[model samples]
Target: MEINTFRESNQFTYSWHAIGAGLLASFVGFASTFTLIVQALINAGATQQQAATGLMAVSIAMGLAGILLSFKYRMPVSVAWSTPGAALLLGLGVVKGGFSTTTGALIMAAFMLTLAGLWKPLSRAINKIPSGIANAMLAGIILNLCVAPVHALAAYPLYIAPVLIVWLIMLKIKRMLAIPAAAITTLAVIYFTAKVGNIHAGDIMPHFILVKPEFTFSGFISIAVPLFIVTMASQNIPGMAVLSVNGYKPDAAPLFTSTGVSSLFAAPFGGPAIGLAAITAAICAGEEAGADPGKRYWAGIVCGVAYLFYGLAAGAATRFISISPPVLIEAVAGLALMGALGNSLMNALSDKENRDATVITFLITIGGHAFFGIGGAFWGLVAGLAMTFFLRQRQLKAA
Candidate 1:
């Protein structure tokens, strides 16, 4: 039934199904990527405390944003930490100015995102980016991380094999549960293989951490712009697509504006970047949430609420990650993202008009080359756009 009609029917029950769906999305997303989030923060020069705080901050930011947006708009508007942004941090290794500068970059990216919302031209320009190129860029950025399991297997086959076997079996049975199951298995494997001293059970409780941001020109150019691009093009755009597929066209500008503001609020506490969620969004925006689309917003709201609870345990999660083998963590994350990568590749090559340009974008992005401190993601887009524009001009001349 249509959303408005469902609203008219007054059948909205605070159903367990909706709540369960939300919780499931929350578990899958958080369990799958929280380790990566911590790893990214640490790599960017955050202290362990700062990394934990950042994870908590982003979780709360995304959770609150998701709840508010879904409740206000009466749609399943899910928000998430920028996974690509995390990957970008990982790829860049350590920034010169350390975590303080990285926080500054987060603030800058938030400001840019806010501008993208307030300025019609900026939003239009973002939309003007062809899907093929955007998808290719996302695929390229994540290519290395997705292949981590392969590398992990060669190094520690005994530990990784069981996890992989369970993940594959679960993928065949239930795709959503696949990553979470693997994550659980990974912890068990860590328990058996790693030294007992690695697991610091007492540090599981999280504490508030404050890190004052220090901005620099290099950080802005290298981190902020690319982050803004990835969050918008890769995360938020796909999130909107998920909503549209489930039949909802929200006012994008206001949503972006709200999320940007939330990110700003979170930056002081170490939040990296926030955007609409794509993968976990399907759980809340679909029939799994509710038969009635009007009621589906509750699922997103509950998911946000769940994130708040999860964020409360950020200290434990961070400590747990610290104990496990880093490669195993990367492998689990890579497995979770495999579905997204495959979909991106298919979309990137699907259109004959943009096929060549998309290939160029994908290749350059995966090459992992950077110039002037900027990453390959931006450069790949530049190359693909050049190819696309040249192809268009040639076509015009031919016609």
Candidate 2:
């Protein structure tokens, strides 16, 4: 009888932990990237309904996949929409064919991701990139998010100050609850300030919207190729590192394969490109989840459930944002990404040999410069490699 009772107790505890971790992970994960998704959809020429569909599709797929994978692995494996891909989509899809272009690119990218997973040689090559360089790249990619809060403060000093104070207090006092505190404080400040100013409220419910996808050759060339490159280099590479750092040795093939499949499934629905999320995954894998590493799986599960809820209320979410101050979002996202950005920078510049190349990569990436219709990441990497090769050739000649 006592053994049975203990088993039941253990199950309950696991379930609860998973739920809590999932919720925290999902909130932070989505909060970190959802705006970028909206921007991408908008750039892709999606209608309001289509945009909502994209958000919902992404939320559902990420949530379900994250939950299933975490549960299967018995570890936290949180998935997220690919922010870098979304940024690429915005630049490429928005100006060209819009929704059609975006969908076409998504399909193509998914295929490429699948191929990458299957091609052992290519995967191995990718894995061979110096860990320090990869870390640096990841940190550089996230640096903008950390800086955004300062931008937010500049924009709305009156409204953001109170929330920032609350966030700092929570950080110092109740560290685990810092994110939730920032969110709540931001919302409160927005509401009261808006009410006092008599600003009209935005719509709070997501509309039921559907966008049928159409594929095109041009779309594949312009959008798909770039999206594929960025997702692989910027998202998946860093995501794997996060898991590794946490002592979870996940098989890379399944992880990449799952993301590809999920992206394919989500394309028609309205979600921005879905991929592995490095930053949020780190949070789930951290020591705070529990003493037992296995218990962290619950965090992924919780994040999935939250995604579902967010998807269902997409319309309402838009409405809430309409009256809400932009500073609130900026501050929260910036604060959330601070640790990630710091970690990435430290890793990127750790080795003296790689420092110059990594700095070049970071500048090119953050500079937003593109070449031949491709985005910054591809060019940044190219420039870095070119410099590295040149230096190596010089050394050989001297020898």
Per-residue lDDT tens digits of candidate 2, residues 1-399?
A: 001011223543574554565677777766545655664576578865577677878888888888777767666787888776665555444644557656766777777777777776766776666655555545545566567678888888887788789878988996756766776676677667665353323343555465655777656655666566557766887788887887877788888888878887788666666678776787777775776565677787787788888887665444444466654565575676566567667777886787888888878766756565555655666667677778778889999
Which residue pairs clash in candidate 1? Answer: 204-316
Cα RMSD for predicted model 2: 5.1
Model 1, 165-252: lDDT tens digits are 9998998999878888898898788877767575565676767787888888778877887788889987878888888888888878
Report, for all candidates in order, the number of backbone clashes: 1, 19
Residue-pair clash count for candidate 2 = 19
What does candidate 1 score on TM? 0.92
lDDT top scorer: 1
Error of 2 at 142 (Å): 5.0
For this target, which candidate reaches the highest TM-score against the unseen true structure? Answer: 1
